[model samples]
Every structure is written in C-alpha cells, then in structure tokens.
Target: MSTEGRSAEPVSATSALESAGFVRLVARADGDGLAASGLIASALAELETPFQVTVGRTIAERSARVDPPTNEDDRTIVVGAADAAADTDDVIRLPATDRPATLEAVDLVREIGGTPDPVLALAGVVAGGSEPGAGESEWLLETAIERGLLEQRPGVAVPTSDPIDGVAHSTRLRAPWSGDLDATREALSDAVDGDSDALDADDHRAIGSLVALDAVGADEATDATAESIGRLLRPYATPDHAFATLGGFADVLEALARTEPGTGTALAMGHDVRETALEAWREHGRRAHAALSSASTGRYDGLFVVDVDDGPVETIATIVAASRSPEPVVLAIGHAEAALATREADSLGATVDGVARELAGAEPETEPAFEDGSEIGVEYDVGHRRSYLRYDPDLDNSTIIAAVREFR
Candidate 1:
C-alpha cells in the first residue's frame, strides 16, 4: 500500500553484477519470471560470472533456496517480484512493468557485452502475453522479424494442438462446447476436415469465425468477449522456436513453469530440454483441465472462490479469474496451498499481496514473521495481479472464506 522507498532509482544490472563477488538470481515460478531470470543467467553464463538461479513464489523463498548462502559481498538479483523494490540496498530488483522483463533483461545482457539468443529473447516476450497493440510487444515482434526468428501469418489464436483440441482447451474462449472434446470436434466438423494439424487460410478463417461466434455467447462482458475474439483473430507472429509458433512456445513455457519450473527455466536458458518440457506441459494441461472441470465454485461479493482437492491451484485460479468467473477477483484453494488472481479491470484497488498479508495476520512491523516458519504466509508474485499463499494443512477452509469475505 505504501509507495515510500519503492521508487528509488534501480542500480544498473551490469554494475550490480560487476561489483559483486558473486551473484544469486531469484525469479518467481512463472513463465515471464523464468524467462527474465533465464535471460540474465544466460548472459552471466556467457560472461563466465559465478551465479546461481533459484525459482519460487517470492523473493524470500527463492533467496532461501540458495544452497551456499550468500555473504555480504554477494549481490542478489530479484526479478518479477511484486514486493521487490529498487531501494532494497542488499538486493537488486527488476520489478514487473507493462514492458516484458525479458526485453529489459535483453538490454542488460547487451550492456554487459553478451549477445542474447534471438529465439530465447522472443520467447520471453511471448511468454509475457503482452497485447499485440502494446508498443513493446510490437517492437519485440518487429525485432524478431528482422532477425528472421519470426514470420507473419494468418492463423487461429488457440495455441494448442489442432483446431478442435485448441478450441476445447482454450482458456480465453468459454464456448458452449468447452471441455467437451466430442462436442468441440462436432462443432468444428464443417470448418475443419479430417486432421487439422496443418490448416490452410480458408480453414483458419472458418475456424476463427466459429470461435468468434462462441465468444459472443460467452458469460463474460461484451467488451471482454470482443477483446478475446480480437486476440483470437489477430495475425500470428509465428516463431521459428522449437515449440513452433510464438503462442505455442508461450503456452509450453507457462505449462512448464506451473508444473516443472526447473525444466521451464532450463528451456528458457537455451537448454536442449524441449522433449522433457513438452511432456511436462502435456501432464500439466491434463491435471489443470481435470482440476478445473471438477472444482466447486462459490461466488462472493467481489470474489469467486474455487475449492479443489488437488492440482495446480495457481493455474486454475488464473483461468477462473481471467475468463470463467464474473467476480473481479478469484481465489483457488487446494489441500496445501491457495492462489489469488485479480482481473485487470478490477476496481477494488486492493493488491492481492495486501489481502494475503491481512489473511496471514502479518503486520508491517513484523514482516519477517513470514520467513520465521509461520504456518500461514503470503507468497508475493511477480505482478500485482496474482498472489500465492501457503497455509497449514490442517487449516479450515471456512477460516479462509471468512478472511476473504472480510477483505472484500
């Protein structure tokens, strides 16, 4: 809530690394977070700089994950953390921004005299999910085109397998046939022929039109539905990455980050882990789809609560908040952990981190309590739109519901 001490000028990434005896890079366990951290780590590796990379929900957790504890002379760079600040003297923070952190990392890598892999850099931008209209997104795409890493093409927006599977698995478009493979296939029968692994321009347009029709009937607001359709119909900036297209690569990164963050980070760092990452992504999609389909949901004043026995809570929460839930915010609670996601248009203005702290009874004066083995602690994410909370296994769901109601 307080902005004081958060606006101090950030130290140059090059300077921070050059001045430190050693470096520790901490990134949130998300696609963009891993991409940003991986970009910096790749640059550092190229320079032969001693560094370690750790991934977690928060900076504290990641920093603590480092094996050989950092000393006074070591510099810790924290990226994609909402709670991080440029003013933190002991740590260098690359806080989230409208511009993808990957782009920022690219600049830093260049400043440090390391050439970033064009594909990896573009993947970072794609993983960020910035709108095509965004200046930064356009710049990144144009750069990719100039570097011959991407080609413009007309295609359906769903990044999944074929047209049918993509429509069924699409999180943005909540069609009537959603979650029903048979129904989806039947609905696309007229538009798509036998196997749609490779679609022509006519097939793309036909499929896009059907998707738009579905979006119009979605439960979301007209503006939201229109935005979704626009994105769905937008020109594809096809990438030459291992994952094929830009959107597909982003989806793989996202799925890997949620299911196997280590693999995601390795992939982002130009490692030959594509096969492993793809497998992890498929498993993640299976688990997430199952959890979302079976989950019970409750609508509150300003929040939508989803109760699930197990699965990826963060992924489920994000999907619910983004497309399914009518509420401005969503909370998905599983047996061991919980995730909160806020709609971009939310008017409450209360940050997820603030709500989480309140729920955990963590006072500003005693902030360190979160790191002192507290049973309930908030995990600050890379952006204000989401937060993760870990609570005691025995904690009652009723207590969480009550706290969330009070926060609303």
Candidate 2:
C-alpha cells in the first residue's frame, strides 16, 4: 500500500497481517483527484472493507471531514509511514518503512493495547514489505510474545522455539571480531570443518565482529565481503556449507541470495535463512540422518572436487572436461580469484563453492562463446584447477584478481 520503505515483510502479505481479527486499510491522495479516488476505491475493494469511495471534481469539492473520535482510546496514533505524513485522524503513520500491512499496526495496538510488544508491531509491519531489517522484527515480536505482551493466535501462532537470527551486525561491526557477517560465516565454516582458528582477528577492530574473518582462507586480492548464512560468515562466500550437518544448503544460499555483501540489496529467491545448525538439528535431525544414510547407501558416480584460483580460464576448462560426473565439476576458489573464477565457472558450466573464509565463484555454463578475434586457449594436461592457478607462483595477486574478473 505504501512504498515509504515501511512496507511489510518479504514473506507473503499473509504473514505480515495473518490474524483474523486484524483488518487493514490504506488511503493516499495527490494533485490528481481522480487517480487518488481510484486508488482509495481499489484499496478498499482489495481489503474488503465496508468503507465507500467517492470522488469530487476539485480539491475543495472532493471530500468532507470525517467526525472526530469521542474518547482517548479511540484517538488515532499517527505514525509517519516511511516518508509520508498524515493528519491526526489517520491511525498509523509510518515513514519510508510503511506498507499496507503497516495499517495493521493499528490492529496490532488494538490487539495488545500499548503493551510495548515488538512482535505484534513487527507482525503489523511485516504484513507489508517495508523495513530493511535494521532490527529482526519477527524475533523482536516473538520476544515480546515471550514477555507476555501479546497472545499468539490459535493455529496461526508462530513457534515458541528460539530460532537463530542468522547474523547480526553490532555497532562495532568493523571494530574487529565484532560478530559481523564475515566472522559469522567464517565461524560456521570453521566449526563445520574443525578450523575454529579461521578469521583470526579476535578484536575485529575493522569489523568488530566476534568471528575473525582473517583466520579463514582470505587473501587481499578479493574484497573482504563477509559471507555467512546471509553474508553471515565469510563476507564474500556463496552458500555452500555451514557449521553443522546442513539440513538444506539452499537455506544458506537463499539467505546469501537475499542481499549483496556490501550493498545489502535483496536478491530475489525462495525462503529466508533464519535458523542455526543446532535449531535445525533439533527441528529436523531425524530426517537429515535418514536422508544422509540413504544417499550414502546409493550408487553414485565419481565425485570430483576442484579448487581453482587466479589462472587462465583455459586451465579450468580443461579440468571440467576431465571430470567424470555427468554433473559439472565444482570450483572452490579463494577470495582473490572470486571475480575471475566466477567468469571461468560460467564458461565451464560449473557451480561455485565456498565457506566463510573464502570466496567461490560458480555458474553452471561452461560453453565459452568466443568473440570474432578471441582465441581458443587451453593449457596442457592439467590435473586440477588449483594446481593450474598455482603453477606460476611468480604471478602477482593483482593478476589473479584480474584473471578472476575476466575468467568467464
């Protein structure tokens, strides 16, 4: 309803205002009286409310004042929705973070009646698609629910479990080991692979994250984009693994897909990564064991794990060609080679792989389409992508970075 950045959750409109007792409404007006009137009518129709819509030929002629409320309890609390301002009679005013569901915030207040419950408030906002999650609205709301400020709806109630917030940035994000996304990702990888020493900067002065990003396999060539469950661990890593038995790798990848490391723009994808390994383990441990055991017992083809770095794309092409699996080979690369490796993976029809300590560039498209003057180059029989990149220690890191950037 409002794009003031106060729109509700990325989830569905249903989750944001899932309560039956809640009824949401919205209204807007601009210089064009006809357009404004149409929008009001549309909103009312969409919401299935009893309100009627009427349009006037001019600003003064268009409408009349609605009667004021009789009591304080009925007085409206006008919040600035995202970036807009409304009069006192208008119930909810959100600025930049307002959405149609933000109107549900009125319903939220009515539900809890000034109980200071973040959960109900968040639920109201989540009903729309506003807010950049400066705070975990859902968790904050759930916390409020735990505090007994709001009551959960029957059947519509959220779980009472303590779900993982995935990753959070403290004020000291760059202050060294502050538990920022980078450190969180590296911690997960380290915890999984038994390399807790990853990202060694315990102080995290620059990042101030609890997890040290440097301890992981980091290099200067690649930018320090902490990649965690949602850019939670290594600042630059793609979704590949986590600290515990991965229930589904997509959750980690899905979270990473939500936003870029530096820009924080939500990349369109399915589902949000909010739970930790322990919570997942408790929630679906039985299913995981059964699936893993089943996979292990199956007859599978050869598995080839390729680690590539700053080298010519031609070298990686050779390795992909040699892999036995019908499924393309996987390229696990370091941070410096990320850009080039991503290009190379695309050209080779392979997927990228990574943990928090490093960046892995992958894409399942190996067929390189050459330009008019492009040359078909492939190095001699190479055993692995990593070896080819390392074949020349004389190569400077900058060159590796450039190669990664231009690999595809």
Best by TM-score: 1
Writing each residue's lDDT as its tens digit, candidate 1 over 1-408 gives 221224224346567676667788777677777788888898888777788787776544664544343576677776664342334555666656446677777677777787776556666665565654256556666666787777655556545547676667554445666667788888888898887767777877888788777757665433455564566564554554566456666667777777788888888887889778766765666567677768898988878899998788877777676667777778899975777877673322245445555655632333333344653444445344666666545557777777667766
Instruction: Compute the lDDT of residue 234 as modeled in candidate 2.
Output: 22
- Count clashes in each candidate, considering only residues at least 3 apart in sequence or on different chains: 1, 92
RMSD of each: 4.6, 20.9
* Residues 229-338 of candidate 2: C-alpha lDDT, one tens digit per residue: 12223221112222221112222221221122111011111113334422432223222222222221111132222233322232222223222112333232322222
Against the hidden reference, what TM-scores do the models get? 0.81, 0.21
Q: By summed lDDT, which 10 consecutive residues of candidate 2 come out lowest?
A: 261-270
lDDT of each: 0.66, 0.25
Angstrom error at residue 214, model 1: 3.5
Give the top-scoring candidate (lDDT).
1
Clashing pairs in 1: 80-382
